[model samples]
Target: MSDPVSEAGTIPVNDSTPILAYGPLVLDVPGRPVPLAMKVSAPATGTGLPIILLSHGHGMTTFLSSLRGYGPLADFFAAHGFVVVQPTHLDSTALGLRESDHPEAPTFWKSRPAEISFIIDHLDDIEAAVPGLAGRLDTTRVAAVGHSLGGHTVALLRGMQTRDPADGSTVRVPDERIKAAVIIATPGEADEQTNQDMLNNYPVNKYNDFSTMGMDALVVAGDKDLNPMFSDRLSYRWDAYTRAPGPKTLLMVHGAEHIFGGISGYDASETTDEDPERVSTLRALIWAYLRSQLYPDDPAWNRALAAMGDFGTVEAK
Candidate 1:
């Protein structure tokens, strides 16, 4: 169950450690073991660390392909005292079954929760095996951060339902341990049928069902995304529709594209390059949200969240 890409052993803690691998964690899908790639760094002294599960977007290639597109967002989080687990949801990408060898290729989405569950199930083992991460992981403060289609996956991980028409049943997420989520550029409007199915399975009226599962959430998008309608207006609409009680925030980054604020690999135009100001804003918002939820008494958290909109001033509804 070793990762085919990395050397099989515990990676020592280092400031520049690029990739750490964890495996032997069997997925629910037969014969497919879950592989987690992460950036591990020493936590800041006296600060309790939290875990962030970063999910990649869908594309015509593997999750690694998308990873190559995102910059060091994961490393940034790790350096800031968080253990980031970036799972390779290869089957869910555009390349689909071609990238995964899972026996149940067609029903990949139904099993994504299992992939997440596999990782959650192994946190104790991972902390034990990797010295640097020992006692540093605050599992209760976990967050799911995803981009594009990956954002949808994050929602599902928080118990949002996606109906299986074939079986007339719903696919519920197995891992309810995620305390908060950040969904970037999520598709605002699904097809009519899918929308109806989602309503039937997990109605918007019961959005509390999903929000209660998490501590807080931030949904961010860009004004000039690929789908202008969804990325802009619709995103705001959806956010308004489900403004759950646990401190939800919606942000629209001006002049940014769909892939902005992501890791370096996806920005073909370099147009979506992380604006230092925008990145600072994003870091501030995310850190604030996590802090407010995980360590409510910290004034710095509220300060950061308050100052989030100042960095990249915009007229987002």
Candidate 2:
């Protein structure tokens, strides 16, 4: 695809190009028997580029948990000159591990953030794994981007605390390395009426308190992306943005679903609302946000919001 710098000005994040991908790079977690493995993607060129540590949502099955998920966002970010690192958490169906398998079960909410922190702690090793990628990254300009359940992980690192499903205790584990974040289709305050049982099933759901998210972030949601299992209303997903403090932006897609136009895969059947244009739209918006947030005095965010003025409602503070 041709690299077009139209809407986002400098960040040509929508154009797909040659990307160097290295994966399954095993890193031994301190005490866990299971190692933390991740995949790295680069632009195949460039130096002093920014970094994006991406986390995939706990998908229905293994593929999304593996190194192959989020083709839309991961590939786009790499093409635009950001080194992307994605880690498969222990909760993934790919590993088939459970609460019985280790300690954190159902969803490794606590462990998930630690995994991201681990990756950040060892960025040099990850960067060296990819050929022609040495000294090509600006480690200080890092952002965390996550979708679905993975979105919750980024929030935690950014100061959003959740109740521990294991002990019913409120836990907040923040990593100062994460300067900015972009969360998509992630949960918000627990719905009192609809999520009582869900809270019991996943106690951490009750811990989504947005009182202290004082970091830079962009929350993207879909108008129709309702959580049938946890919410009776469509607005439940908006809690991530609406409830959080300022210095955040909320982009609500006009008529998007959970998958948001096949972002999970190139052509997954889950995309009941398949529209590649929507995928491209999100890519552009996110890159613009990342670009502006990462670099001071950058106007890509202004240009992006102006370009997307007609597509959706972007509430920024």
lDDT of 2 at 19: 84
TM-score of candidate 1 against the unseen true structure: 0.68
Index of the highest-lDDT prediction: 2
Off by over 4 Å in 2: 1-17, 99-101
Report the lDDT tens digits of candidate 1 across residue range 164-280: 544555566735587767777654444332344433433321221243324346777665565433322444323422543445566666666665644335333443554444554
Candidate that would win on TM-score: 2
Question: In order, what is each prediction's RMSD in angstroms?
Answer: 8.9, 3.1
The lDDT values for all models are 0.53, 0.81
Score candidate 1 by lDDT. 0.53
Model 1 segments more than 4 A misplaced:
1-47, 61-69, 92-107, 191-215, 226-247, 261-276, 309-317
Which pairs of residues collide in model 2?
99-105, 163-207
| Candidate 1, run of 10 with poorest lDDT | 5-14
